[model samples]
Target: MTVLEIEYKTLLNQDEFNRLESRLAHVKPITQTNYYFDTSDFVLKAHRMSLRIRTFSDKAELTLKIPQEVGNVEHNQTLLLPEAKEAIKTAILPNGEIKTLLVQKGIPLEELLVLGHLTTIRRESQTSIGLLALDYNQYAGLKDYELELEVLDAEKGKIDFDNFLEQHNIDFKYAKSKVARFTSTLKKNDQ
Candidate 1:
């Protein structure tokens, strides 16, 4: 399945996340781990794309995200644990639409490799404007909080997200994706 993901994201500190969590006492949270992949030379990142296998308690999915004019277009495919393991073992892209899409875009599927993993505890709420999520993510011993709003209308979603921040008096700046942050930290540690 393919979807146009329209979302705005921002970073939050621990105190801000705690405050927001208290306000969202009614929402249930889910925990998941995301294992990110890219070529040795970071071909996917060079193309402004990302690939990951997300594992929840009961299911797993392989996803590819390609940048679009308005938002990222995500392609997702369900995977069995064995299949995911096979792909990881071979350092190959998962076999399905995601692989076909990458081949179509001139990315060599055989070169894909695991970058790292991030685990997140997330709670979501549906609003008139879109889906709002509060996320606490950890990777490579680093942890952070984030707010994400995914909507059908980008302009309206931005307005809603901005208003929410102001209403809470939370001082947040724009945040990069988990994969990006993890890779940056890895690079810094290597140096």
Candidate 2:
């Protein structure tokens, strides 16, 4: 399936993360692992595209995200456990919607390879304006926290997100996507 996602995200200081979580009702953490993929030459990065297979406890799904005017166009396809494993080990996508989309975009499947993975512990809840997610992410020997608000309307969501930060006395931070951050760290460590 394909989706257009509109959301606002910001990096959070530890204090901000804790204060925000304290006000929300108690909830169990949802843990997920994302195995990111890219070409050695960074073809996908050049186009601001990202591909990954995200795994929860029992399911895995491959997704390719392309930048769009409002947000991103996400193309997703479900994968069975065996298929997910094989793709990770081989860096070859299984036959699915994600692969079809990549083929149409001229991404060379043979060159797609696993870069690495990130594990996230997330607490999420539905708010009046959107879905609120606070995430603690671990990758490449680094860890950080983030707050994200996903909404249907981009303009309204940005306003709400900004107001939320102001009410909490939190300053905005330039938040890069998980894939971009992870890849950057990976590139750094390789040097």
Candidate 3:
């Protein structure tokens, strides 16, 4: 499955996170574990692409995100329970759209490795503006909160995200994608 996504993100401080969580207290969060994969040399990073197997509850999805002019093109495949477990344990991606795309990009399948994993407690709500998600993520001994808006239009979404923060008197903080943050933290820890 290919999903065309336009997403905007902002970092949230602890206070902001709590405040928003209170506002959305009616929504429930699902626990998700994300296993990131890359070549030893990080060829995927050089290509500005990422591959991950995300498991929430008993379901797992293998997703490859490729940057686009607007947002990203996500190639997602549903993985059976056993396939997901085997892929994570062996650090190999099962044959699917993601693998084919990676091979096309010249990433060596043999060199691919499981970099690390991140766990996120994520709550989502559908707003008039877009689909809003509040995430508390833990990885590499680090924890952070973020607000993400997934919309169909990038420009409008940006405007809406900025305005939402401004309306709530929240300062916009820079945030990297979960993969970037997780990989960077893991690299520093390895050093």
Model 3: which residue pairs collide?
none
lDDT of each: 0.88, 0.91, 0.91
True-structure RMSD, every candidate: 1.3, 1.2, 1.0
Using alpha carbons, what is the TM-score of model 1?
0.94
Per-residue lDDT of 1-191 in model 2, one digit per residue for the tens? Answer: 99998899999999998898787649778999999998999888987899999988888999999999889999999988788888999998989788888889899989988999999999999999899999999999999999999999988999999999999888899799999889989878889
* Clashing pairs for predicted structure model 2, backbone only: none
Q: What ranking of all candidate models by lDDT puts the best one first?
A: 3, 2, 1
> In candidate 3, what are the lDDT values of residues 98-158, reduced to their tens digit?
8888888888888989998999999999999999999999998889999999998888889
For model 1, which pairs clash?
A: none
The number of the candidate with the highest lDDT is 3
Q: Give the true-structure RMSD of model 3.
A: 1.0
Total backbone collisions for each predicted model: 0, 0, 0
In candidate 1, what are the lDDT values of residues 38-140, reduced to their tens digit?
Answer: 9889999999999998888877889999889999999999988777776666767656898888889999777788888899999999977688899999999
Candidate order by TM-score, decreasing, is 3, 2, 1
